[model samples]
Target: MTDTDNRRLLRQLFDAALAVAQPSQCLHHFLPPPVKGRTIVIGAGKASAAMAAALEAHWPDEDLSGLVVTRYGYAVPCKHIEIIEAAHPVPDEAGLVAAQRILSLVQGLTADDQVIMLISGGGSALLPLPADGVTLADKQAISHALLKSGATIKDINTVRRHLSAIKGGRLAAACYPAKVVNLLISDVPGDDPAAIASGPSLGDATTCKDALAIIDHFSIAVPPAAREGLASGRYESVKPDDKRLQNVTTHLVATPQRSLEAAANAARAHGVTPLILGDSIEGEAREVGKVMAGIARQVVTFQQPLPTPCVLLSGGETTVTVRGKGNGGRNVELLLAMAIDLAALPGVSALAADTDGVDGQSEIAGAIVTPDTLFRASRLGINALDYLSNNDGHGFFQALGDSVITGPTLTNVNDFRAILIR
Candidate 1:
């Protein structure tokens, strides 16, 4: 295929991956029956608003009233549910308020009521209600450290669950007497309910001790009060057997694997064989990219894994240990590192992006790499290694006009990476 053809196909694959994860596509089959008393919809994430709108469509005649917090640009208009715009990947005042408001709405609910929690990725930061003795600023510091420490989503969330009032099944506990139906969109590796938004509407299997271990392992500095809460178990999350959480039920409406399968099917339609490397791959960003590059190189040089005219697809969250002074969206960093390792190997082209259409704090989804990547950069006096060293993959890709932009996809399934070999 020509360069233009390769780029177009890669984008089509990416789009297909995103399309299947939209609430409109994956949420229909998981809707819960209306409660006898009332339907209270509460959520937090990049997809919360869209998921809310989806619920409204399915239950247009039902009396649905609640609140959802989402990334600022991700809000969609909902008839009964109030949508609140908030910051993500970092806690803000807006998120704190929304979290408190959500908690208040679920209180004093009767057994006849049901809480429909539309949870998705990014909810941890978007619903940052600090626990007693912990300030919002304290949680923000911990979040900042964990994000840059290259900690796994599980570890980061373990700490967040202990420090927050609304995470780690606490939200479900507060809704006692009222049954909880957790409609989740999985973004974490392995689709662990407790890791998806820290299982705000489900039981948490992790303990405060786990949170303490993560903090120490990551060398994350915590405020004294926050430290004491974890050390003393004063901020423990609701456990799986917590009596208050006995009535909670969960449904995983969408996930990374399903999205990857959708993209793979799209590749087949294009006459290209697709191999899914994994759906729960995890590690430091650049290292994982190098490993992926090695696999792609093997396909090109020895055709070991597969012959030409095939694509490799995978999905999961990759951590970026940001030690550089540039925008280091894990997706872009992976693409940049892969490009460097490939050394513009012939017959290889790839695309990497976050399905949510935002990487790190940048609006850019991710970027693309091709066989001529090195040559193109050299011609433009852009040193790929220099940019990678400074963790400026977003800058490098933007300068080459190769960064992918898809304003807000309104859904999140972590990172999507595809490599096409020809």
Candidate 2:
């Protein structure tokens, strides 16, 4: 097949993967039956607004009412549930206000009242409510450090749960006797419910000591309030087996593995043999790219893994250490590293994109790279190695006109990567 055909196939596979995670498809299965009393909805994530819309469509006469927070530009109009747009991967005043409101909404509910909490990947940042002693600025500083520290989401959330009033099962505790059902879209690698959205509605197995250890491991600078909170034991979060969560139920509606399988099915439909590398792969983004490049090379040079006209598919979140101040996300960084490693290898092309559309802080979803990416960049006076070293994958790909832009997909299942060897 031509390079264009291969690229088209890759895009098709990506779309297939995204479709499997859409709110309309995944939310219905997790929805609970209508309750006798009022049903209060509360949630925070990039997908929360879409999830709210899905709930409204699924149960138009269920008498549902409440609020959900999502990233700016991800809000969908819902008649009953109020949708609030807030900053993602970082907390803003808007998010703080909305979180406070949500906390208040769930309070004072009786055992008859039911709370349906929609949680997903971006919820940790979207539902920012600092502990009593800590200020929002402190949370902001800690959040910035964690993002740049290259720490895994699990470690980052370990600290987050201790610092926030709403996370770590405090949200569920607020609804004391009320029954809480958490409908979650798993974006974390292990699909830990406690880690997804910091487990606001589930019991937190992590402790203050775990949070302190993570802070020490990353050498993250903590504000005086946060430091004291971690050391004083006064900020302990709700623990597992806590009776507060007895009435709470958690459900996993969508996940990365399912999305990857959808992509594999699409590849097979396109007459390309699809090999799934696993959906939960993790580690440094550039390193993972190099490893994937090696696999593609083996397929091309030896044809041992599979013959020509084959596509390798993988899904997972990869981290970047962020040494340089550049416009790029993990997917772009991975694609740049892969392009450099492949160099001039013939008949190999690849695409790496964040399934949510926004990759890091950039507007582009990710990028597409061919074996000639380096040669083409060189012709344009762009040095691929220099850009990669500077963490400027967005700049490099943008110059080559290979960046894929799909603004705010609203639903996320982490990263999607595909390599086509023909």
Q: Tens-digit lDDT track for model 1 on 45-152?
A: 999999999988888465889999999889999889999998888889999999999999999999999999999999999999999988888888888888888888
Q: Please, what are the lDDT tens digits per residue for candidate 2 over residues 1-422? A: 67788778878888998899999998998888877788999999988999999988998485889999999999999999999998878799999999999999987899889999999889998989999988888888899888888888788999999999999999999998989999998888878889888888888888898899999988999877788888888789998788988898888889988998998898888788999988878898899999999999999999958998888989888888888878548999999988888887999999999887888888789999987888899999998889988888999999989998878887888899999888
lDDT of model 1 at position 158: 88
lDDT values of the candidates?
0.92, 0.88
Model 1, TM vs. native: 0.98
Candidate 1: residue 189 Cα off by (Å) = 0.3
Off by over 4 Å in 1: none
User: Best-fitting candidate, measured by lDDT?
Assistant: 1
